[model samples]
Target: MLTYQSSQDISITPTKGQDKPWLLLLLCCFWLIPGLVGHDPWKPDENVSMAIISYFMRHSDWTVASIAGVPQFSQAPLYFWVATLFVNALSWFGVAAHDAARLSTGFWMAVGLWGVGLAGRELFGRRNGRLSVVILLGCLGLPLWGHHISPAVVLLAGFAWYVYALALALKQPLRAGVLLACVFIVLLTGASWADALFAVLFAIFLFVFPQWRKFSYLITLITAILIAIPIAALWGYSLKANSSELFQTWWRYYAWGPFGGARSFAVGTSVGFLPTLLIWFAWPALPLAAWSVYLFRKELWQPHWQLLISALFFKSLFIMLATQQSEALVLPLLVPLVLLASGGVDELRRGAAAALNWFSLVTLGLAALVIWLIWIGLVTGMPLTLVDYFARFSPADVHWKGWGFVFALLVTLVWGRVLFRKQPLGRRALTNWTSGLTLVIGLLVGLFQTWIDVGKSYRPVAESLSAFMDGKHAQCIDVSTIAKDPTAALVYFTDLALDARPDNECLFVIRQTASKESATPEVLWSGHRLGDQKEIFSLYRR
Candidate 1:
């Protein structure tokens, strides 16, 4: 038989030793602040994000988003708009445009962590809220994707807002409705939600869980949709008002993409997405979250547990089964999983606790050591082979920065101090995992930032291409084979008006190929980065 949670049972009272705001703040700073500002826009995500941001900086057009000079219909303007603001705001303070745009991703990520933490508190307990954040910080995939420029992270913040708002809906129906309305607008406006329909349906679906079937909850659900309508319509109206072509393109392509995957799961899921890939992607949190669900098997119908389960089911139904697969799709899973994992920590058995503590120690400890050794190699010339190995990634003029040593040493000392402190194994395990992750990422970024930046940066290659084009006073150039990622990078780095579409009639052509040398006699320029063999771009006369 199911029972309702008593008012007292759900009340949140933070105990002094159980959680501390200062400690949580410190942990967040340690995890988020590193590896954010020290590098150039790396390819895959940052290049495109910065490219879009760069586009906004030069053009007064905010209604239509574009990559280079070509109109891009699918991208949501919200991210570029936000990123552009960050770049402009930070430029007066001496931050570079790319670094400031990247910081926009960090800003969204911080919001996500806050929402997730607060949601955990509302759904589970105050301590669990803090633990949820730690669990999320300890996730394997976060450090990379969370820091890079992508609206997916913004969507993540929206999901966190959704969960947080839903958790609030139980108590404050009207307020929760208004909050959910804002969340709906945010999701609907961004590229994250394919359509606003599912978000609406999902609010209604919550009533299926018996605990939330009351009239107030019904009012909450109704209020959300009613309020959300105007904003979504206004956005649509704005789009159509700006240009019918852009609105039609968005509705046709971007809005319906998620539902289109239902045709066949065989197109990708089982074969392409190995189960272990996501297992490690979610890491220790997944296992703990699963254990928590099973441990409370009898209480699975409880509102908090049921809410998380339903949310997970709702998300995974679309994301996990989608035809397209990227590691980022699994990020939203972390919010609920980490929240669940926090509950699991409360009931953590002695053996499991011991195992978790040792696991964090062994795995992250070893990783930290390896990073330190590599940092040492990069700084001092004792290990010739190792130094020589990393040296090839950057230009010959690039030298190790002294600031790397200072930053790395401070991180190491702090890590060493925390490593010996006594605490519950579960809390200790979470702490060690996040701390070690911070230390490792900190060392890499602080010690080898220039090397990593040089290897991945598009600046060198874009500049080379730009210089040749300038020397020739190039016009009507072609970009037939270039991928969008590099094209965006070229737009950002060179400010080139690469709008001309490709055809045989063009006077100049720019194509990217794996071949090191162009076979054409009309070649004007050919180049790649310092150690890259995969991409070699060439420009030539037709």
Candidate 2:
């Protein structure tokens, strides 16, 4: 029979061959912080969020979140609040507006990792805690969404803090007040009322287990509510005072709105599809976490399991039931999932461990290799097929960066060494998996960032539209109506207030009309078609 020992039996100290936690952490930073810094805020969330921050910077108003002059109620001001600080602070160093704003995500991403490590340590031990952070670094969804300047990413940080602070409520009961303060911060920083509600529910669920029904735990939760409500009320009062219309709009649209679409609900209801989703969505961590939960079936009563499951339950419930089912919704679940996955790392069998190692070595190794090949093809057209393929999509003016190649090559070399190194099954395998994942992410960022920028950025379209407006000397433009992408791009490129709603005073109007119809409004004296007949945009002088 397979036997298991307590985490106390394992050596927390790293041997010479093993990947040190600090180095693993540094590698994660390399994977996370690099591309996020230099890139423009790519559409849909990044640009939208950054635009709001830019608006706040120009106007210096925290009471209402907006883009251009349009008040946006979909998100809370907390994300923009933090991002605005970076936007102004980094401006001194000559960072671009979007790049400076995105600094918030980088800072919070690090906090999320630190919180994951702490939760793991509190639940398991120091060794598992470090390993848990590694596992989180290797998660499939993080690289895509973790760096987003959206409220969802900020919610992720708040969720991580909630997990860490909750663990503290039981372990260090004397610091209940401190833990409660963290809970208050979560409510204040979260994107929506739903997120704050989930946190409260998560706290209550922790005390549901008989063993955790202590006076300190109860008092901490009660205090958390008392602390959180007043803080939330203060923001609410300010919002109401500054813009009552926005306050009502937020309450009516989002506060208690029925959430989730057919696709998202399908994930919750359909047993058949969930496994498929989990396979790619949660990936290596989900499988290992499932295995760990199965092995520790009798120990589900523990506070760690209780808290993780509670958080997972509420977050998943919201994702499945909400009106919009974005992949970004999965961000909040990563911390608890990583902590649970770390529990199974030590109990993993030799064959299973070997399988994981080989999987990482092949899959991530191949991914890195492909990214390198593409990067080379982009720089030099020796491989005519890849060159032709890329030329069809990206501009012919794309240039090679010598520094990108050097950085990518160095990271790939380190990845190769980790892959080939002979080491024991558990922690070594986990660390290598994270290192491989980081290397692949690094390759994409270092090599393909500009390429990605070409496709995703709205700057070109924005610039094209701006060219039509240059001679007119219009102070502000009016968008009769436009989609999200074009609207955001116009705001950034034009550097003018765009009114989408009906207004009589605008000197110029940009509208998206039917292909057969002229984009020009009838009331305008004259208009200029922004693009060719195939494209839809017209700048009209009223």
Candidate 3:
């Protein structure tokens, strides 16, 4: 590792050997486990995951990606298989299907945190590694997207492990090869081949960098690729053998079209606005990552800077050229940025660090209090000021004082204890920030999980639609205008027959619209989640 100028005074705290990795593990658990379960499949992503997993559990189809008996766009499904494995394993212990499926997030997020911490330790020192993990855990965007069902999270794990394997490639060839094998397996199997291509690109770019331009690194990459080949090939062979047509469809997914079919572009409005998205989503880490570069302006060519900066630059280019954006696409960039920012923590001016730490403590401390107060209003309906605001989410009939309350209360107390403790010097500010972020998420999910679910989930609508169907002879229903979120939820939660055959003798149609429209025949059902304004569903009999 290249030592920083004026290193003695600014370094984190000497070269501590291990830095209590177990503590980091415990923090990861705290950070990862909270919002994993205890709620129904919510909105676009989780509902889609539940639909796919539910189908897989019943049919055990290894080669095809079908949801509700309809084919999916991207066919490579190593990620879904991992989640299925988790669901199957957890079912023996009687866990709910959706909850079990969500456990996959915790498992992969842990893998990511492990890789991130190890890379920090490898490239810098133990303290910096732990600090890196802390800073990442504290980032505003991670907790929001990390705990959900998305291939982006799995790709995140791959990136974290990729960097670690890259760090160890030349020196610890054997271990690095094993880690890189896992990374490739992750990139190859579970997610989109489009996103995985960048991992491979990053690896190739490493060869072009001075640090990775060594015979041993080349050997390590080849070994890992060789290890990953048989597994990927097996998946391909199975899919091809199962049905040649299915394999063809899977192969042409993004190659033929950006989002599963031929399309000019993908989701999000524009690629140009991505940096703006990164501004909030990447949070404190993004700025610190830039600060790391500024601090070492003279050492841009150093091996560490070159590796980190090149990774960032390549991912930036990939994000722009890919023509799609989300919190997920922004995720891989964090690994390099956090690793880069890990060193910046130490070099931060003492006064600035102190001011930032106190500011975090005060802001987070107040935020926690407000969360508790809002939670209290949710339970007792006291503090009438908040009651009106909370009503927008949940009905007045919704009231709870369950075990989640006790759990959240304990968490808030723990956060409070940490906040009021003696002021921290260097790394403690990050600790406080991450803890506060976790606390805020915990309080919201624990206290008002019911409230949020009431608004976000399509369970109520699905159940109502199912009841409406049961009242009459079961018949195929038209789903011409229904959005994907409700569509997936209905498929997962109900037994209604959904189809889009306009010529069929279907009497019922389910359509979503911005404003309710009058149907000539008697309407079956018309409603939406109370807080959702983007869509309202109406079931009509034509």
Candidate 4:
């Protein structure tokens, strides 16, 4: 029912207002698919974050550990405060803290999805908006990250939406300055200091852009910085107390294993490094994207160029500077990519739609093949080499059985209908089939592999500690070895106070490597004894 002008006249135009509701509904469904799979309680980060929440709920103190009845600062307490509210609210209604944390994560993540939809609608027309929402929700990264209640993901999503809204306001002068100020504040609150430099850069970009008609650029810049003052003060205070140790730990993380020297330059190490390069050339949509940018060169030179360039630069720079890297961080930059890609798709004239259709088919086919191979590995009981490699260092077990079948079946059903049916499907049908299938696959893969099965490695250790503390409700004293993961997991699962001193009474130790002689503590539980290393849960009671 929709129509457009000739390819030469094609632009990234907005859709009719009448189409807004339908697009919104599709976007909502895109978010719902991932939400329905339920949250997994097994991720170490999730476990620790939830544990911290539970501690705040049960105790009056907000410390990560209590020493001699004195509270000591640990990580930033903002995330804990948010999690605590959810836990307490859920407990009042009779839900467990863990479930509360899970539900809260889903709720915030859905809010984040709404933010993404709003960003899409503002940057592109309703049709491109629908595509942006679909791509974001369907992407493997978003759904996986959504389930973990880390502030990093929440900040990423929120800051991205704020940036999008700020860009939109930049195009209109009357309210642009105020909106820009407010958005800058929100970005600071959402991401803490992590987003500070990026936010400042964006604010500068907005004020200096030629589109602003009234307010002086200098005045706008001063107002933006003024708005961010409270956030900066709070960040400084948090740093003075809790940030020093975290930076040291982070530095160690960067210097060591996963983030270490040579491996840091590997294919997936930087956020957009690989994907951008790959998509620019090899992706079917590449030509369309190139043509779109080419056609819109004049528009690109205008005020909007600031947004596009700032987003691309900041996203790349931040990821490269990070001690940790993952593809999910690139989600913020997808808006620009979608705009460029859509513009490119628009330039193909009469053959544009046909070309897109073919590209879509090929992409779907490759995705299906990848899914099939994964399923085969799962169902056949063959070791997934990548998973095995991870399991070697962490306390996780990989199961490939049901996951493969589920993915394969889902892919088959959706593609089967799309390929075989001659009748045109409605928007709901397309959104549901494509986005829904993708969501299912993402959740299953994330929950089963990343959280559940991988959690198996830590389960015995966590459970052993749990069992040892059963009914006694004893406060934990000290735990030996701080490898970020095992120590973090112990604190999370057991909600126990940790001590670094070996001389402390009532010590609990998780020895990663075996020793020739046993210590004073009785070994409470042991797991799958391998050669030099076996995860042992021991308790030294005074």
Q: Which model scores highest in lDDT?
A: 1
lDDT, each prediction:
0.75, 0.70, 0.74, 0.50
Q: What lDDT is obtained when candidate 4 is compared to the true structure?
A: 0.50
Q: Write the per-residue lDDT of candidate 2 for residues 200-259, one digit (tens) a residue.
A: 776777666786788978888877777678777777798789878777776666554234
List where candidate 2 sits over 4 angstroms from the true fold: 1-8, 11-19, 174-176, 257-276, 396-400, 420-423, 471-476, 502-507, 512-536, 540-542
Indicate which candidate wins on TM-score. 1
Query: Which residue pairs does candidate 3 place in steric collision?
Result: 78-189, 78-190, 79-190
Greater-TM-score candidate between 1 and 4? 1
Q: lDDT tens digits, residues 1-542, model 3?
A: 43333374344344455345576676677678788887788866888777777777778566665654566654357667888899899999998777787788878888888889888877775566677788889887788677787666887888888988887876787889888887887776765656555666677777777767888878887888889867767876887898887667666655322344333335333667668877877777887888888988887887777778888888777776555455677788899989888877777778877887877878877887887777666567787777877676766344456877776787787777766544336577777888888788777777777777777778888887788778663787877457666777888898777764445556788878787666555667887776766578888787
Residues forming the 10-long window of minimal summed lDDT in candidate 3? 255-264
TM-score of model 3 relative to the true fold? Answer: 0.91
Q: By descending TM-score, how would the candidates be arranged?
A: 1, 3, 2, 4
lDDT of 4 by residue, 1-542 (tens): 01113243334333464334564464454444433333335544665565456567667745343332223233345556666788787778887666667666666666666665565555554555455455445443455556665655555455555655555554443344555565555445444344555666666655555664335545655666676667535643554366575434433332222233333322234555645543532233334446666766766655444565556666656656655554544545554554345433434455555554555556655665665565455445466684454445544443444554365365456445545533112223333434444644543453344434443345456656677677754665555443444555565556456654556565455445443336444655444322215444445444
The residue pairs found clashing in candidate 2 are: 259-321, 259-322, 259-323, 260-322, 260-323
Residue 187 lDDT (model 3): 74
Root-mean-square deviation per candidate: 3.4, 4.5, 3.1, 7.7
What TM-score against the true fold does each predicted structure earn?
0.92, 0.88, 0.91, 0.68
